[model samples]
Target: MKPSIVLVGRPNVGKSTLFNRLTRTRDALVADIPGLTRDRHYGHGRLGSKPYLVIDTGGFEPLAKDGIMYQMARQAQQAIDEADVVILVVDGRSGVSALDKEIANRLRHANRPVLVAVNKSEGMQHGLVVADFHELGLGEPVAISAAHGEGVRVLIELALEGYPEPGDGEPAEGDSIRVAIVGRPNVGKSTMINALLGEDRVIAFDQPGTTRDAIDVDFERAGRKYTLVDTAGLRRRGKVFETIEKFSVIKTLQAIEEAQVVILVLDARQEIGDQDAHIAAFIRESGRALVVAVNKWDGLDSYVREQIKGALDNQLTFIDFARFHYVSALQGQGLEPLFHSVDAAYKAATINLSTPQLTRTLIDAVARQAPPRNGLFRPKLRYAHQGGRNPPLIVIHGNALDKIPESYRRYLEHLFREVFKLQGTPLRIQFNVSSNPFADKQAPREKRRERKTTDKAKPASGSPARPRSAGKVAAAVKTKRPSGGR
Candidate 1:
């Protein structure tokens, strides 16, 4: 497994900006406004063959040390407990504040490998201002410009120096199916893992906080290789106010990142809430396989199941590719369907179709529905190729790739699954646009050219250019061309 790292800093200190730059994605919401990032966001990170998870945390404050902002501070402090390495980002333009000093002091007590980043130092003049941050006693600080992406490669290399993946000297490890059992606290995360292992693999408790570590247990089901990770149950900030449970939050976020297939376990009686949706967003953002399992599903009626799925469909609008199954870990009533959904999500991750078939499907999907627009450029996904497995990566080359909203992407994903029969597995759809969508439009241009030529060739005398209405155009097309031509 890859190591995990956390980037912590005060509000408006460029932590989220650095997160977007490192992850090469706008996964964290960025705005000129401060405190836009209310919760923790984690991203996939790598540098020169080393892969680690990076986390973007909420802002920290000095006056509100015991307040909500301080709760966020405690969360960042937990980053040290869970991370193999820690990155402390500070705004160089603002100089060093007392809050930064407090975070540095906390990290120093944790005794972990820490890297300090002085952000917003793009110009030569800011060098002197950034140099003052070295006084924090954490060696030379790396000056970076997160928005313009300056000095990020060096910062990533420095962050990964302590986190090299273990090599077995053989062909890379065979794809061991990763199953992340995730849900709200005390919802049987430990109970399911213990049942799977047939031993006391984790602490089974009615009280929350029974499991803090993201315990990964590798075993075989029949002949299939599997890794079942029981992550710490997630609790609301209102629930855990202390400084110590911060580590649990970090582990939970990292576990969501590392898992290949997330078994999003839901409490059968409870309606899914913001926390469940929050975790589902992690799986969706990570582009991993998703299987929505309604845990403790025994002794329920058809009406209840329908209510559950309906609630799920409404809340899980973003994850159109995920398959849902109601299950009881205690009785194992619906596990086969759940596992089958897992198998489908796994296949969806690596599902490959002939390029001809995919291109044809692209034609059909776009013909049925035009590409979603981003200003003038309609972000057209021209072609796609399946690149990776474990979680399938379909790289789509297009125009205005950044404008392809998550909803349109899901529309294409739904079409691909419906047309090609991709079941169960979570798949990643990557978009890249080379040219402007407006420039390469053929049908509109052809029609304009044809109309211009027709107008020029019209017997240019008193044959008045009477504009044709919709009904007139239809009637003329029917009369002039039996097959419905202009």
Candidate 2:
């Protein structure tokens, strides 16, 4: 599971800039104005093979009681509560302010790892700039320039130091496909699990927030093994009450990460809300194979069904890779087809493609529609190979690949998905821009050795060296003697 890193600070301290640097994306807005960010922005980032989720929260004002600042503080507090690691970003050039001290005091009791980052310290003396922040008492302040991407990598390395490396999680038992059922509250997730198993394996109540824990059940269907994980329904953070429910939400998210496939159960009766879309987006970001099940679809009229379908198309367009099944989990109406999709999704996620086939597909894609040129450099795609599975990763080797636009990347992804028949899974493309071999200068020692070798191969001191080319030799022979001397 990817660890969540939350960035917290007072207004305009460059938290969003650091977030953009850490995630290598512009998902977070950066500006000089204070409190430019009001809500939390989330992005996915990877350092080497370790993938992690980052949250850029609004500026923190611990004393704000009633205004918009108060709501922003609340949001930041919630992010800190859910974060595995918290980074307190401070303005180094401005020095440590009173508000920075107050925020530090608040985080001192957070019961999690806290790192103090001194931002906008690009050319300043790191020792002096970090000295003033040590009084904040969080920890040693690490000087960084988020805009220039200085010291960001070291900050993240220190933040994620103790977490287990990627692919180190507990392995699934045997060959069973680990499937997690997740959605908003009262979405019939438990009922879906019960209908699939043909037994009351979990409590399925009509009331919201019935399940408070994620339960795993092992079962067989049609000679295939599956481990069904029924997770507690997720509600909006504002509506979530009690500490246990909060922990349950964390467990639900963890289950989605651990599972090989996720079945997002949407309530057909309710309009597709933000909570539903947020959960779907998380599943897609997690790179898990998805099968969206619109539960409680037993009694909707044709018009209402069409309306629901259109809503899904308009709002949940990000998850178009997943197959949606309008099923009545209570009546076991669409169990067979849903399971078929689940199986197909799982297969597509873990499928392996040969290098030759992947390269051929990439060539065909580029030949069909070449990527647009970026200024003077045109992106050149050479070959492609598989990097990982579960979420199929296609690593393409090329020159000037960094110039590839997002639209062209999506085009290649679509073409690859079509060629490979990869359905119900998010396909990731990693561009490895090959370094120019001739860019490096020859070593002084090598240059000297080559010069000596050329000298040794030349005619000795008293003999003229022969011209190798006929044209050069004729030109040399035809040259007039200087001052009537040969």
Candidate 3:
């Protein structure tokens, strides 16, 4: 759902390396060797004031399909097709090659939004050499050295512009993605947002409750708009209803209400508490897409880190579907991936899948892996219907419905992930089972028992029941005898 940003170009263009850099974590395998990345490895990533999904694909090559690299190329092309925005990363030192032109031609046909990134543009000596790559006809290439972290920001801004404006009438249509930065007091919520925004749009101080009102600032990166709303820090429950805090509470709720999404920041230095969970619950109750960002992640040690992460996620169990990221707001680490996840989750929540496409994909998924078999009587999974959205739910109807195993359910999920590409979106499935299609009713046992019951009620002993004529004679005799006796 997040606008997909895929890096494509010839091999060894530092795409995987950039992916590692942007996401602020080593999600993709990086090496000096060309074509180290074959499969498409993806991670949540962000740029100034914007979040998106970054897909690091295998390098592109032309005139060669001889071996593993060819397969890698195939995968890269697939990523290009799936992406909302494509970055053609050309190596500045090597200059452009015939392969780059081939890739450009393929990308031109893709018709998805694209940007040309010229990497390794360090020092003036390399500038003239990189200038010749403009001949690719994709547009002006953003020249920078990704290893040294130059020009990546500029290119990111360019890439962020590809995000389409929210559907027609949504407020902030021409403006930025309106984000409400919120959390308990002194959790460094405002500081985190400010760090990501990279400007003092909101005041930052060591004071726990310094920010007691909602403030909105128009933030932009690479021409894309983002509205960052910094609000009053939340307080503990027992002291919550103080007379002075009335306006603050109202303003905080209003800010959350107005936000398209809420970034709930937590202090990683301290253990996650009831207050953090309470804020997350508030966001969910308000029907806002919530992203749990653990600020000050740099201090986490190797030990107990997973235990703490597990603790934070335990609160989100019921909502198997919220996004969480560990970030160091002060150092500005781990933000790209966090924001990327935020963007993806938001986009996924709003997207509507076409019925025909969904139907086809469902069928394909069923073909790949059959539905669960309770026993000999497999739940004859008939057809699936898109029951709802806003967290898309699909209902599958079949027989013996209860026996379907979670294992098979996960398989269906994987298939759905592949076919429809519902990344970062929570999927709900309802299984329905009905009577056998070929039979008038269930198996013959019930009908046979009914016939047997009727026969048993008619006969008293070993003899058969009386005929219709016999029943009439008996009724006439009984009427005459009863009248005489009366």
Candidate 4:
């Protein structure tokens, strides 16, 4: 395993910027927004050949009494405890503040290898900017600009200075599926993970918000590797005043986007609410496979279970494709079935369909119901094929496809879902209306056909005039070359 280095500092001091620089990826959300990073975000970095784990922590207010500041401080302490080396980032432009001294004192007692990084040190002469931070008394501060990639190498070298070299045996590298476990506070998310791993991998307490950071726990089950991301429970934004939970929300969202499948845990004893529905919708919008797990279902009566199922059905109609399971995280009841559903959902999300099969399905479905007609013209649906996966998408090409109503679209989506047995993942059907180059020529040809039909219908000199049937004239209009030459 690579040596872990933790970045601790106040808000907006460029810790995330430095993390992005070291990791060479914009995985961390970067903006001018303060307190944007409230949880410990882990990333991998390599200074030349030395690979290390970098953790970006929320701003630290060591003596904060209540609310979010205290929670962030505790989270930072946890990261520091696990880290081999700690980099304390301070603003060079703003100089040192009282909070910096308090954090410095705390680190002094931590007894871990500490390095001070004076950020925003670009363009200024060496002694002019770093001289004010001498009173920090940690050590000589490494002047660097995290955003500009200046002095980062020296800063890392100084931080990793006496650390033992990494071993030859690195972590297994391959296609490991990522599954994020998410729910509201105290919903047994952490408990569920601990039960799955059969160990106390994370802190599980009765109090809400016990887990303030998104932690990734990796383990192999039945020869299949999976990374279980145990995330902080999300509360509704109106009820959220703390900065820590806000950061956790961002982390949870990131986890969902990164993971191939998300398990939304729910409390069976409590009433299902709008927040749960909102989260499920977000997962659907992100195109991630979803598995709704009702936790603490060890002793629920059949009536209540049915009630819960009905509520889920009504509230999460958008994600009707998602799989639902009832389980007790504490006792591990129904876990096997939940995981099996997860595997099935992941497979469904990435399932590949052949063109011939998709076309046949569409043709059969359209023949059964027939697309709605617009006035005198009935739209024609040509064919469909798989456009993408991970929330499988099918693109259909046809004439007047843009005119397809939302109701009809849903009908086609439902049909495709049934045809593919696509459960536990949302399926999207897109219509691509092909344009005809000979549309002008088509109008003239139809006019000529109408004239010829009129001429044929007219009596020749003395013969009786024959009447034309509506079906023949309708067929003549229908024969307008199928849209788009195809």
TM-score of 2: 0.75
Q: How do the residues 1-486 of candidate 2 rate in per-residue lDDT, one tens digit apiece?
A: 679899999999999998998889888877789999987777778888788878888999999999999988987887888889999999998998999999999998888799999999988889999998989988788999999988989999998897877762224556788899999988899988888888898998989888988899999998889989999988887787555665577668878988989999999999999999899988988889999999899988999999999999999988989999999988899889999999999989988899999999999999999989889878999999999898999999999999899999999988988989999999999999999776555577688999999988887877787658988888988884678674
- Order of models, best TM-score first: 2, 1, 4, 3
- For model 1, where is the 10-residue window of minimal lDDT? 164-173
Please, what is the TM-score per model? Answer: 0.72, 0.75, 0.47, 0.58
Note the residue pairs that clash in candidate 4.
321-424
By lDDT, the best candidate is: 2
Per-residue lDDT of candidate 3, residues 1-486 (tens digit): 346688887888899878887888877887789878876665666665355668888878855767977767766766676677899988887777889999999889998888988887778464585679778888877787777888888888887775654332134458567678898777787777778788766778886778877888776765667677888878663555334443365466656755666788888777777777777766765546667787877866877678877886676664445677888887888888877776776676556667667667667776877666655766556667776554566777666767888888877766765676555455667787776676866558788999999987886778786677988988988777544553
In Å, residue 383's CA in model 2 sits off its true spot by 4.5
lDDT of 4: 0.85
Candidate achieving higher lDDT, 2 or 3: 2
Tell me the spans in candidate 1 whose CA falls farther than 4 Å from its real position.
1-3, 9-52, 56-73, 90-106, 120-122, 125-127, 130-135, 146-149, 162-175, 242-244, 363-384, 395-411, 428-486
Deviating ranges (above 4 Å) for candidate 4: 1-173, 440-486
Residue 168 Cα positional deviation in candidate 3, in Å, after optimal superposition: 11
- RMSD to truth, every model: 11.2, 8.0, 24.3, 15.8
Clashes of 1: 11
Return the TM-score for candidate 3, rounded to 2 decimals: 0.47
At residue 36, give the lDDT of candidate 1: 74
RMSD of 4: 15.8
RMSD of 3: 24.3
Stretches off by above 4 angstroms in model 3 are 1-175, 239-241, 246-258, 281-287, 299-301, 304-307, 313-323, 360-378, 385-389, 395-423, 430-486
